[model samples]
Target: MRRSRAADPRGRAADRGSRTVTLTGLVAATALTASLTAACGGGTSTDTEGGNTDPKTLTYWATNQGASLEHDKKVLTPELKKFERQTGIKVKLEVIPWSDLLNRILAATTSGQGPDVLNIGNTWSASLQATGALLPFDDKTFAKIGGKDRFVPSALASTGTAGKDPAAVPLYSLAYGLYYNKARFDEAGIDEPPATWSELVAAGRKLTKGGKYGLAVEGANLAENSHHAFVFSQQHGGDFFDSEGKPTFTTAANVKAVKQYVDLLAGDKIAAPGNAEYAQNQSLKDFATGKAAMLLWQAADTTLKSHGMKPGDYGIAPVPVQSGAPGQGRNVNSMVAGINISVFKNSDNLDGALKFVKFMTSDTEQKHLNSTYGAIPPVKSAQDGGTFSTPAQKVLRETLATSAAPLPQVPDESKFETLVGTAMKELFADAAAGRQVTEKSVRDRLAKAQQQMQS
Candidate 1:
């Protein structure tokens, strides 16, 4: 499932082509540190003891980005072996599932018992950086892992606040894409993927029949729901936060977006009635099983193939925009950073870990690993020269370049996820249960959620 969440293989061509936004400042360090400590339910320690003192050995925790843990090991062993041969450093790699990664990371940060290097979801980068538990990539440290400019600007921006040394660097990059089953489209007599929200609904109406939904959605997973909300809000020319980084979930644009999202089920009835309980995996399964005709996802190619859906069965396109909105038709997309690499501050093998980081992002490794995982490589060089061989990868690269924005980089990002996601979940529930979800009702719910954040 690491591959499912870590690198969906559904979106983004290359990180370099993505739009970049500069996030200027961070919440006060003291407050951020305290927030992380409280959230993780752990106290930080400065202990650097018990680390492998041998310059030849390093520990790494890799997210499950392959078919399985064993598959990841098979893919990574040779690469690590190559690194050892060249740098004389032996890496002990542990492939962790997405379900256990965050907890394990918290335990390691609190107890100083963890790998020297690890992969984390980029969305968690700022939250983890606030803990002061990550080894930051400063000027000196960055020099060891190739220069800062070697990374994709947009990908690097997700690692930390602008003007601050980031605690991680983008490893694999991703972007959102509209995935539609070609067979289903043909069956429905649809000639092309929907280019606008209205057209999408119209197509959905045609695609929905014989117990098959027009679209699949992840309503139960708050994180995924929040991601969709972010995209919809942006398409409506609204964002979750204001210019000052304060929550603005109840803005008119946001309410409209949320209403439109909920209307897909409540008003349009294009999605399955039971979809309110669906998570990302479940929705993806529904799509794979032909229960849905369209899905918006990123980096899902390998997983889709594993699910028995071949590349030719599905087509990838940019997510549609609101045609009548202020920025309608403007290229805009969800905030997506596939997976990022971070070094622990308490690692006994800092030098070795840095070496591994550099090795992982190197052109050769980037190409090999990303190719195996069916994801976009974060390095510019790896993406050029026909490195992305598939049509989906090519489409994603162009989408990232023209669209893609990162989630808000506020210190309270997790709070935003919980609040906005929960609100969306409630809306979905209301729609699923045949309740009315008017504009005022949506505004009221968002207002309540925003108040909870402030409180």
Candidate 2:
């Protein structure tokens, strides 16, 4: 969800507090993103046994955030400098925005000019792995990085596998939830945020008023929009994919959920006007500014701070579900999200890069990442010690307790999400226009997308 950017005095003070805590947290977190002093178990250098001649140097590329290279260098340069002092190796670092990352990687693969090590979004693991552009890490490589046992199984599972080889190592993790404005709820006479789909709609109706939307969303965000749709489907005991990983989103439960998704803007009239046109960040912006009362988004605690909202002013809960579902399933499904670090197949500094990846995923480093970047740790132990250290953390931790599932980990995931979302958008527009959504339309649309996925 987007965070509201209102200039509340108390909210401003809360923002300062968040920054202070984050700065203090970075001392511990920066370790995950920074330097590596320990040796990796798989220590074969192309410079030696692999018939290569070059100085011992490693190049790293990452999407910028958490800390910029300038700030990262302050923390990591010292660590790399120390590694050089101890191991006689040098490291170079570069940052790229996410928008250009994929094209750049594809270009590098074609030109044979890719960095020795690359940080990738977890969602892209399967796609990149399919290209055979990354070196698959074997047991020996895991042992070098302190083994698979050191990381969270969920994070480890996100990286693709070709047989026994791991395509990448997770660097951080994310999950989505509902972020509500506490003051708005109070004003609307809502004692607590709704816990079921029916109650949520009721709450939205009560809260929306002149010039304010009860909820904010961006139907145009095809990839992200699917996250909400899937979550609602799960809450209603539905599946977007059959056991064979084929599309099955036309189920009755799913149709109902899709109607709910559209009803926020259409029937209820509680969503921002022109919401269908907003992009990913716009909803977040609307929510942060108090233009919307509720939002469904991922790991927004940091952004909440930027929008001048605080923990007390905001309440986060698991995504609400159908009135009565099995497991008292109040929460919808969630996906594990994060970035993964991997070595390029043709990297000359394999040993150095592998060592660096391990250092980043280690418990100590994971702790640093949690503290510094406000990102969840990919290592289970490190996450336990990290920033999600309060009752507020429980809100997220518990929400994920529901059987949250991820998008299909397939090479065509991006295309699949796009197709599914495009179909959903058309149906959603109908739902918004007060047309009764039915199983026929949902099923027909899904079947077409499924066929396209197979093709």
Candidate 3:
């Protein structure tokens, strides 16, 4: 019953190699915070009627990776210029917010106004691949980019579903980690971060004092709820879907998993009720500030830095499980989190787009880009040493290699995130309002999601 790990809609994804779970139940991103909705409509001002076909020019849609959109532009500008100088191909880069990227890409797919190249959450790999809008990296295409072996085997796994050519190439790799406020832990006399869920709760109760909370959760964000739901379900040895990919969301284990998570607020009373109002990135803010003592996030080093948290302010550890040490199955700690570089199949400048992907995946670019963003490079060589060998990186990298699992590789994986995550959101709302969050209540909500999916 127990299986392995996996992101945000703005984006989360990971590779599933030898440890791949054929089970269809585990489909949700604990990857970095992904915005489930796009706030500002969709589409850029230009690129209205298909992409720029100019052989020497290419357009790329980059996800928000830095402290702010402006920061990303500052980081990527010179890199794009460097690529231009090397290949004589000009890159038109648009930094899309995580909030609207998926919708914008879908709009681009339907209207054919997308860019030549773009980044996608690895969680969307199979779903997007099913649309047949992305270029497939077949053996021939893999050869074009220094062979398929050039990438970390696990990162490559999230590129798409099994037995098919990857719909994209892994660029920046990530995995979830438990980040704790060092001083808070020290003040509480907790010598180390939590190793088990029970220990986490005990630590949380001790940390909850003076109007501050022990933990934070993006309780209102559907994508965030869905991710934790999937993760907690994994710890409880439950599956959201059966082997044939049908909804199985109301299992006993599922109820137990959902209850435990909600009980953090309803039962244990560690997380604040205000967390139920958190949808954007407030949980992150809460942890960055002193409002909360701990946070579980996908590669949050850069974001923490942006929030004015000094490097030594916090420490990273594996997300806690029910019990035992983290290895796989029940011991698995983090879901795969990463971004993928893809070429639109309809692009007029496919060559340039492919070249751009190759360039980004190159060891040099991977090093600079991943290091700059505090993300791990999916390229095997780039992951070997250097910045990736740091203390924080070692935690994330080890998780990806040994414990990280992919979300379901189903075409409708995104829908699972939406429906189930939303269902959990409503439950949290009820909990925040002082309503009883019972096992039966959790089951009823999940059953409704199952019915909606069937409908």
Overall lDDT per candidate, in order of appearance:
0.71, 0.59, 0.74
Best lDDT among the predictions, by candidate number? 3
Model 3 Cα RMSD, 1 decimal: 6.8
Q: Which order, best to worst by TM-score?
A: 3, 1, 2
Regarding TM-score, does 1 or 2 come out ahead? Answer: 1
What 10-residue stretch in candidate 1 is worst by lDDT? Answer: 16-25
* Candidate 1 ranges with C-alpha deviation above 4 Å: 1-52, 324-330, 387-389
lDDT of 2 by residue, 53-119 (tens): 3436777775443223354445456656655675676777776544345556666665556677877
Report the lDDT tens digits of candidate 3 across residue range 1-455.
00011247424422111011111222322121222221111223234343443678888998777667788899899999999999999888898765566667766665556688888777778877876778889999888887898888877877787889999998888787888999999999999998888999999999999999999977766666666777788877777878887888899988888888888887888999989877655777799998999987776666677798886999988888888664334765665667888987767776677788889999999999888877888888887776888898899888889876666766766677777877778888898999999988999999998987776
Count of backbone clashes, every candidate in sequence:
12, 14, 12
Q: What range of 10 consecutive residues in model 2 has the weakest lDDT sum?
A: 3-12
TM-score, per-candidate, Cα-based: 0.87, 0.79, 0.89
Q: Model 3: what TM-score?
A: 0.89
